[model samples]
Target: MFSPQPQYNSPHNQGVVDGIISGCKSFCLQTSIHGFNHIAAPKRHWIERLLWLVAVATAVWGVVDISLGQWQRYRENPTVVTLEKDFRTWHYTMPAVTACVQNRTNQDKLQNAIKSRWNVTPESHPTKYLYYRRFVDVVTSSDLYHLEGYEEFANDPDLNVDLFELVVELMPEQRVKLSTAEQITTPPKWTPVMTEVGACYTVNSLAITDVALV
Candidate 1:
């Protein structure tokens, strides 16, 4: 009788099965290369936390930089830009005027500076609006003009200067902010104050101080 000895599984086969099981367990613990799976939660959470921190820090730095006024570049040139804006706003509905200015303080070197420094004639309107407006405001100062002896020309230099100055600093300078008079009604609170007889005044009394915050 030929007895067939049952073939016994070799150690090599057993080893191969063990290796496959170990590999499968390693893949599960680390990552599944071939199937849809989940990433290790701890590593994912760490990355998210780092990103959130960086975002918050960036936002805080941005706010601080703006508050410090470190980014201000054109702030110094405000006088010119502001004057232009006010000119456009005020004259939008009204007819524009020609204005002239002479240096009252430079009396010693009058004729020389008048020729070199002054571009516009005493009563003639300059072509440039910005220059004309500023010249008018400064030349028209009551005291300054009085010294320049141009007071004979009749115009409201004082009132004009005050208004021009007021407009220039209205937004940035606290002193020039719109007065309480501005908020109350349509018409302005104070009219141009008249000097005793014929002279012009620059600024008038505040009809509305309520606009200011102490």
Candidate 2:
């Protein structure tokens, strides 16, 4: 007589398996993920399950496709620099030169302007005087400064002096020399540009009209 074979599908093993299935069903039913509940539903039809399977497969394919595309882009352009060597002689455009003034505004010029334009002095109109004095700083600074009382002045274009005009008028005249192989002495056309440090001047900028080596 042969020895009796041990039963793999015992009642205890079946109970443990049932518990796991129950837990999974409960989790699927309560889960927020779409189509999971339908897939796990006890009374779900074969057709419904097939449709959900297709939808899941499509979603996975889409994600994989996007991942592959990004990987391809990275492989193609791993670094930002692209280099090319040329042996032929070529004339290159001049680089832009930017100049910033240490003193953003002239206090004397500002005082005079205010006195002439608004007929107000620090003694007479302390609030206006202080606001105007701090105006450039406020405008240039990254931090927000309180402008509670000077809203009217800030809003009115006529009340406020032109920033570029103020910069030019107050800025001390400086001589700029440009020399080339031919001893070009033509003055560089300076264009007013607003920078983080207030009004600045740039030479050989695209904004300047008729840019030439001379």
Candidate 3:
């Protein structure tokens, strides 16, 4: 007579099956509890939300204000040139200024004025006028050429106010005329019609006596 065989899962297999069933039940229970808790949690009152929003905004504003203050501290002061026209002369003073690019623009404006006075244009003696541009850069870049405050200028034992005069006297047109041989032999030495006063003492607070220039 034949006997029926009995199959049984190994202990390791049984343990795995039991663990899977237990884990599924635990996961389901935890999910249900989590769902209920989330539903039961009290909603934030409108006033509380508004307060939180205000707090966040205030924090952001504080950060921005601090950043702006730091930036202002490190940033360079504006280069301001005050020009006054009295009688036949144009008197200009830059109380506090640097040799940065902004000041460079102010310098350009003065150069243009001089150029206009001399009637210097690309069409009229282009090569000759170009030399003035090169010469002006060389002369102004020197430390001695930067302008100081009026006080410093006045106190200087060796004050040359005449030299500070911004004037471009165009030499007689006949004098500037050069022959082909002279042009080839000499890289024409040029004198800048406009000159700058030496570097000035910088002050944090400058008075605006004339707002017209502003």
Top of the candidates by lDDT: 2
lDDT-better candidate, 1 vs 2? 2
Candidate 3: worst-modelled 10 consecutive residues by lDDT: 166-175
Tens-digit lDDT track for model 3 on 1-214? 9999998879999999999967755654466432322322348576665665566567768989998886775564422212222433533332332222212223445456446545565567788466555444433333344433233335444333232232222121112323332224543332222213432222222432221111
Candidate 2 segments exceeding 4 Å error: 1-93, 123-128, 136-164, 171-182, 209-214
All candidates: TM-score: 0.17, 0.38, 0.23
Best by TM-score: 2
Per-residue error for 90 in candidate 2, Å, reads: 9.0
Colliding residue pairs in candidate 1? 158-201, 158-202, 180-211
Ranking by TM-score: 2, 3, 1
Q: Residue 13 in model 3: shift from native, Å?
A: 99
lDDT per residue (tens digit) for residues 146-192 in model 2: 44545545566755555445455555343555554443456777665
Task: State each model's C-alpha RMSD to the native.
Answer: 23.4, 11.2, 25.2
lDDT of each: 0.39, 0.63, 0.41
Model 1 misplaced regions, further than 4 Å? 1-44, 70-87, 90-214
> What is the Cα root-mean-square deviation between model 3 and the actual structure?
25.2
lDDT for residue 196 in candidate 3, whole number 0-100:
36
